[model samples]
Target: MRRTRAATTAAITLSLLAATACGGGSANGDGGSNSAPKELTYWASNQGPDIAADEATLAPELKKFEERTGIKVKLEVIPWPDLLGRILAATASGQGPDVLNIGNTWSASLQATGALLPWDGRNFDAIGGKDRFVASAIGSSGATGQDPAAVPLYSMSYALYYNKKMFREAGIEKPPATWDEMVTVGQRLSKDGKWALGAEGSNLANNIHQVFVLAKQHGADFFDAAGKPAFDGPATVDAVKQYVDLMAKDRIIAPGNAEYAQNQSLQDFAAGKTAMVLWQSAATSFKTHGMKEGDWGVAPVPVPAGGAPGTGRNTNSMVAGINMAVFRNTDNIDGSLAFVKFMTGDEEQRLLNKAYGSIPPVKAAQTDAAFASEDLTVLRETLSTSAAPLPQVPQESQFETTVGTAVKELFADAAAGRPVTTESVKAELTKAQQQMTS
Candidate 1:
């Protein structure tokens, strides 16, 4: 029957919700006792739904939202592969969920369609709004001067995860603190069959971010205060070169990494094939990889050499997770906002993080000793001063593709003994800069 959360919402049929979220008033939407109290339909993505099939399965917080707002919320779990397309289709036809779970990076594109309302204005202030989230994560969710489009549900901060067992066995006294130490130790960790680093040759996004961290280490700003590409600067260029050399020139990375995805890197680390990996807060994959509790440790990304000697880049990093947004045309805009705020609030942040093992975006929850402990504490503290996001434009996803292609091409050239000069990279970034701006 494929009944939807919108259908389960107060006995209202999908047809009605389709009308409400889409801003179209279908006859069914305004008709029938099918609706006791007006309902708000929420479409959450696979990130949460993968752990729990639907909101009904995990509703302590959702129940609270329902109780406090007195508005029935129809929670729909849309698979990630299909999420953007389905939401776009529904919204375009004026028949979508009232609220949705969106990647923070998606804000610029989605907002371009004028499909959402910015939560930053005085129109709503439930969970502290901009102050509620770390700067980097919030910035990515489409910030246009006074109008920021989406609110954060939670964030997935990246950290360096190391195999303590491997480090101990190798007789390395402490985990590497700087890029040089990382490289030296990583080289030592590489054995007859194992690689030193979890990041392999492929995974261009990982490589690019590592370069970004390097750029930051050297005070390379991705964009100027006016928001334009700044990678043409020498510091940024150097960082990119260093990363390429690490894998291609230095040979510290594992073999056959070009074809490997992020998951493959995790598997290598978990299997003890690699000693260290750059991981996101969503390391539930750690346990899934048969890593025992405490088998691995987390640290802020280490800085490689550049800018100033012995100094790494700013600890600030771009946020890499999802945020929540309210559809502009929901039947119950007030009720929907209430739910959005509640989910992004401190209380819900705690539950969601604890349940899902992610970094909570709410500052208050980040301070919760119970939820944030040991190595994880760095997340909260660092988040205060060390968070950033990529450009919040409709073309961001496209931009990633452009940058990733360049990164991969550079790596391919390096691996095959081809020239990877600064001039070549500058030209590529120039083309990208043009594409991004135009």
Candidate 2:
């Protein structure tokens, strides 16, 4: 759900060192004696098409919160590219907002810094008990056997979105249910300078998300059970090769897509330049691009030929979403908790998730009729039944950076007409694995 920079590994390592040196103290540098402030600074992730749009959507909600609790919230919607690095810098300096949004996959890696307030029993109780959140949403909140570093806010899962007009024109009856079917259907749909599939090939986070699912279908993981890098394993290599082949061998994706780091693929889908896109909770995005509701259809992402959609080898998506976390050194713990409570409240959950076209992590809010549309139903089912969380290890962020870059380079190679063979993919992955250690 978030992108990582090539320098992320060093940035995080340095931040960890700075946090260790700073020791524990209040965010204001007070000796744990500051009173709760009248206003709380909140760092929200950019959820809408742009930062300005997110600001517009959240303005009324924050106003409502201010009226209800008499606590004003100052909001800054940070873009995805800068969000993680900004958070790491804040952790190091002990100068961060009282609360912030984090990509669920970063929960464990960030928790290792000891800068976030842990959602223990007391905190969960303050926010109406942990049971209010869906289990799948909770699974990615932190590492196994530890207090969650944050609470689930939004829940999402990847699904295949196809243009119905393209399908009808190609004489295809349904979206693909398996990898082989996807290629076959894609071949039929690709013609006349139009691609069958669209991809953010240069996007580190998008590349990681796709390859992660492919690796799962191949009965592999980027990391082994012991949390060590296993990027070049046979199954993993096969999975990466298969994904690159979508452009290289299958020729369903355009070579220009190799440079698509922004959400160009989604735009292409909206403009009918492409037939299908694999995305997480993309309904809102489609609508924002002026795409009509009936123009497209949603289905589960394709799995392996014989595999049914479920956990492990059949997993079709990563548990994708955002989490809300409080800084442990915040000067206004009560106000921060109140803000979190207000944000996670049933009414707010329904309102915000609907506005953003995401599924609410709150169990009660999720059942609202607004979320019962066909597209949401497919995403909800995928999240509950087939999604797997990425490795909740401390080195997870580094893994995203190194391995994602490898896949990006491979895409570039494919675009340049170089063969994306298993051996070449394995070589790239091996280099990625070594970077993690070096």
Candidate 3:
């Protein structure tokens, strides 16, 4: 989801001191002389299934960058879990890489640190213009009316992924458009030791996203005006109840879902052990898991009855994608900015997202052949018509973890065959809401 730079051990302290001693280049004139080539450190997010795959995909592009600008970029592909901690360390030490990839949802959080350069006016002018990217995506880079602190590099949105074979066998003619219909359809489709839905119940990121989407469908905002979490509302409680009921009441989800992570849920759907899962940017991973393109179908996530329309409020998916930012204190600031612009350019975006099975952030790049399929078409439409950024607040990460842990607790009860009432769900949300303030 995000990526970037390093440890704060004693050895790292020496490295930081040495980096500080070297000093940064001035942001005057050409930024760097042609006779003396500039070098920039870049921290790339692990986009592919493995880090090597991302390195391989980016090699030629970095080579092209060198050829074009006489700037050599040293790339480090960081795993998701370690990225945020590394970034926090780097930001604190003032010894981070020149350019880095970050989760789009984290843009606001990271921007609050004041370690990233503002991509507005002249900086924006360097990379085409502010109008170059999709409106929703650029909007995600920072708070509204502020210069974006990062540039959207890859774009993604959630969608309902279902096994076509399972649906057909169950006599289901179409994907459900509402939550109630999904329950009915799932009941019919679940049998023979297989389930209708698979969830990454143990995964905090996955759990939080499901909660967000469902809560939005019920017209609940995780945060109210003034940025305080409003998680214990009736709508929020109902959403959690419905989610937990997939196992407890509906019996359409695997009992083992409590321990399942994102990959496991995806594997279950790919293996045909589950009929459906909510996923994003998983086409390549699914193919790698032995599923062919035609074997599965993609549809927008189902909302509740009387929920918002496709283009209406709370109907959008989260902007669960990554972004690129330049460190404000980089010696090679110009080169870092240039590298970011290069990576997010139309051609590079097409190449990289095609390799990653993701959508390009640039609006026109979505028209590429790699993105012309029916599935990606649905994702693209979601991005334009229905995608919303996660709540923009300083406490966003805390909210995610708190609510996610609460959902995990619900899952544990469901897995152990315990009844999870609406009241119980309310208690979990209330506990999470309290944690947000602490």
Candidate 4:
């Protein structure tokens, strides 16, 4: 979990050309002054139409930006799950918004494409410099080979979310802080033949993030300096065993969980079919299918067995947020930077946090009463105190996907009553590492 400007090295100098154009990107800082009126196009997750409260709040902030900097932000919101494919296609064709919001995990893969603008003192002064964001999150956006290429945006992390009602019914006093305890409590809470652990199997990455956080709790680093697989180590093996045992040995999770992805289990959890789930903190707060505030509670991920006492790893919350970047090729670097600065500035972060329940990307904005009211202060606390970020390597995203996909399959095997032999896992992991390291 590292962040900051990488050393000026050849391997890291990504071009500022739009990746979609398949053209060479210029790294030169041609961003001009904020004196002129400039139109800046933005791409954001469609959290539904702008009528939604969260969606609607940006107007005031945008207006303020326009008045102050003479830059107009044309925001295009795309739903989270449905967005990646279109953005990738658009980017590959070298045409995308001058600034965009993207998942942190996507940073590495995107960096690999050799497009996107790098942030520095000249470009980022309006958005707060390296000092204002959480360190690990800042690192989440940088590639090891390059300078600090991206800035930290709003972020979220995963932990075990439990139904308070279910916990009360089971006579549990406090949330489980260890894997063994989760199994015991989950078993008790999951009754009436319903699944105890409702993991959406198709969403292997989310599950893996949870488990890997646990592995890191026990101290596992997946890749070394060369960006090679280090997953075969002891901590990781123990972590995988724990995950498999929850379903195969404990019989605590739902049946056929292998077939289910995030949406399925979210439906199950909202419907009260399961008691506990390891998911993003924001998932519980989602207002779909009648999800309400009192329905759930967030807890730190349980420590792995034999892990350090009083020591739990905050799996680096995926430093999730939309960053503002200028396409050097966009012909409006100053406009793009101005738009990014305004969109990610203190006022906007405070407003966005208030409207969307997002933790602020800039540290100066965290004092807002809105974050305190939503009680989302913990998300910021966790990212600062416990979480370690993904490595600042271009290969990190590919490796995470590989591991996530493997976990998905392995969990499926556990659900089907198949033996999780070491040989099988080693083979799968080896295959994944091969494709990635190549």
The model with the greatest TM-score is 2
Q: What TM-scores do the predictions have?
A: 0.77, 0.94, 0.88, 0.82
Q: Model 3: residues >4 Å from true position, as ranges? A: 1-37, 306-309, 312-316
Ranking by TM-score: 2, 3, 4, 1
Candidate 4 lDDT score at position 383: 64
Give the per-residue Cα lDDT of candidate 4 at 234: 66
lDDT of each: 0.64, 0.86, 0.78, 0.62
Q: Model 1 misses residue 289 by how many Å?
A: 2.3
- How do the residues 1-438 of candidate 3 rate in per-residue lDDT, one tens digit apiece? 122334642112222342442223245422222222388888988777668878988898999999999898888998765576677677666667778998887777666666677776788888888888888888788766667779999889988999999999988999987888889998998899999998988878778778787777777778998777899999889878888898888988988989986478888888889999988888887887899979999988887766643654457488778899877767666677678788878889898888888898898788888898878888888877776678867566567668888999999999998889988899999998887665
TM-score computed on alpha carbons, candidate 2: 0.94
Better of 1 and 4 by TM-score: 4
How does model 4 fare in lDDT? 0.62
lDDT of 2: 0.86
- TM-score, candidate number 1: 0.77
Cα lDDT of model 1 by residue, 1-438, tens digit: 012333221112223333344343333322112232457777887653253534544556667766776776767777544566565565455556677888776677666655565564553465455676766666667856647667767677567788898889889877776788878888888888877776644654555556666677767755677655665778777767777776766777754665565467888888988888876663566776678878988877665444222323555355677788766656665566667777877777887776666777677787776656655665555555565565675555445545655667777777677777888777766676676665
Cα RMSD (Å) per model? 7.0, 3.3, 4.8, 6.1
